[model samples]
Target: MPKLGYTAAQIRAAEAPLLAKGVPLMIRAAQALADHVTSVLPEPSASRVLVLAGAGDNGGDACWAASFLAEAGVQVNVVPVMGRLSPEPEAGARESGARILTEAKPVDAAQLVADADVIIDGMLGIGAGGTAAGGSPALRGTARDWALAVHAALTENPHPLVIAVDLPSGIDPDSGEVAEPEAVIPADLTVTFIGIKAGCLQGEGAKLAGKVWLEPIGASQHLLGVPPAVTVS
Candidate 1:
């Protein structure tokens, strides 16, 4: 059966109460992500996972997931594009012995993407816009550079599996429209939290999001409400 898709606003509303009650939503999300990552790899211990972490909760999820991967003996390297990371995630990554690349140049980023067996896109989430106008100049530049680097590497090898934390960086969670398609990180598989997003099933989303996986994280359907539209069967 096709999963129900919820808007960004709807997911936020559903998560609010759970967060208020002190649910470990981010931790749950990271665990689910790590499990899926292991499922995709032929040898979890031999795989190299590269995470592109932005400065937000989405990045935190990726950082935590990286920690799990590292603990499982996977070679994990995290590149913080936004130059900042949440304290909890930083601690998790540090304690797990994941290599955190604090200052990565363009060539360095490209090399990392080329060497990775799996690339986790945690640069942006539903709340942030992927367009040049919507984001700060530094962020927009960073996303664009990373996307270009990944594109180049894929053109050569096409071996690294790309996994997105939420919706692919630049896609609209509500409309599935992409303001900057070139800058969007295309995903081979996307692990979405709370519920399926409307954007993942429609328009550019269908093409950008190869295979979509939904993780409810204990959120109820009643709390998420009805979606504005459905784009998948």
Candidate 2:
């Protein structure tokens, strides 16, 4: 077989049936993400991990992973950039002792990024294609602020590792376009779910995404009949 890439729509289609069946895909993704983060850390108990969480399912995934990391004794801090949070996972994160920083200032957010041993970029995912009114895919509001902070901090120190939960927040998942390059934190590793996105392998996205790790989350069989949007030659 060949290396293949799927569009955001196709991936969503593949996920629909599983979600209907209530397969706990988010938990599975969270487990895989937490495992990957732990694997990269040299000392889990001593490390400071920051999760830049948005209001989407991607943010939920990060918050859930934060819970797992906190349970394992990693110092976990989550900034719900969109002000609102995914309540269930956020509750779990809090219960596991992860600090939920809801109103962090831009400078403080930057400092948090600088101080972290690892940063989980969960501010956006493929579902963040556009707004409800069909606007641009650029980062906005607190999410934009935090992304800029992460970019600046990383540029200065370059010490902390970044693990993007899915695709980087600002890049277009189908066209590989970035409306606000400054608002995107190029990942050191991206733990993508289901299939590899076509955009992640193309143009600026390839650069921003870094090493792409595909976590199936039990969606493979559902996607067997769906054709890829692009195929690597």
Candidate 3:
């Protein structure tokens, strides 16, 4: 599909048909992201993973990827934005021996990010809408908010690799617009799934999305009609 400039909803919507056919699109997106996240981890740093999970399915993907990383011996540290995120991926993460960062005192937040070798930015992606409102919006699930707190800390001294699951949080996947993207938490690589959101392909999306790639599970075509013009990626 040429550069269709599709909305986040449209891209995700097109995925519905494929998903219903028992195609593990989420698994592909998760595993594809996992592979990218693994490429940067050195043997020395294989035991440390910092997952900044959001309150959405994208966050779940991050958690799932973390599980894969953990299996490879990476110490996965999952810090959800809210306390207990809905449709949470904690269950899957736990299956891989990953721990969710519970609400803690202010000091503990700093320790988590500093200890992590890799930071998985699972805060938001293409489906992100009213979820990422202000830079520091009210988080749900629990009391302590780790997403913004982590962003603040990472901004000061960012890690070597920031692997965003779908799209970087605070970035519009459809428009590629970043609403005050944290400098401390800029991503080094991004692995988007299903289809490339408009924001991830162009505009500020292009700036935030580094070395973009697709993760389609049995979804080679978006539509079965005349094809659209393509870019020479």
- Number of the top-ranking candidate, with TM-score as the measure: 2
lDDT tens digits, residues 143-192, model 2?
A: 89888888988888898899998788888887667887899999999999
The CA lDDT at 16 in model 3 is 80
lDDT of 1 by residue, 77-118 (tens): 998876778888988998998999888755676678778999
Lowest summed lDDT over 10 consecutive residues: which window, candidate 3?
134-143
Every model's TM-score:
0.91, 0.95, 0.80
Which window of ten consecutive residues has the lowest lDDT sum in model 1?
130-139
lDDT rank, highest first?
2, 1, 3
Query: What are the per-model C-alpha RMSD values against the true structure?
Result: 2.7, 1.9, 4.3
Candidate 1 global CA lDDT score: 0.80
Candidate 2's error at 141, in angstroms? 1.1
List the pairs of residues colliding in candidate 1.
none
lDDT of each: 0.80, 0.87, 0.65
**Residue ranges of candidate 2 with Cα displaced over 4 Å:** 130-135
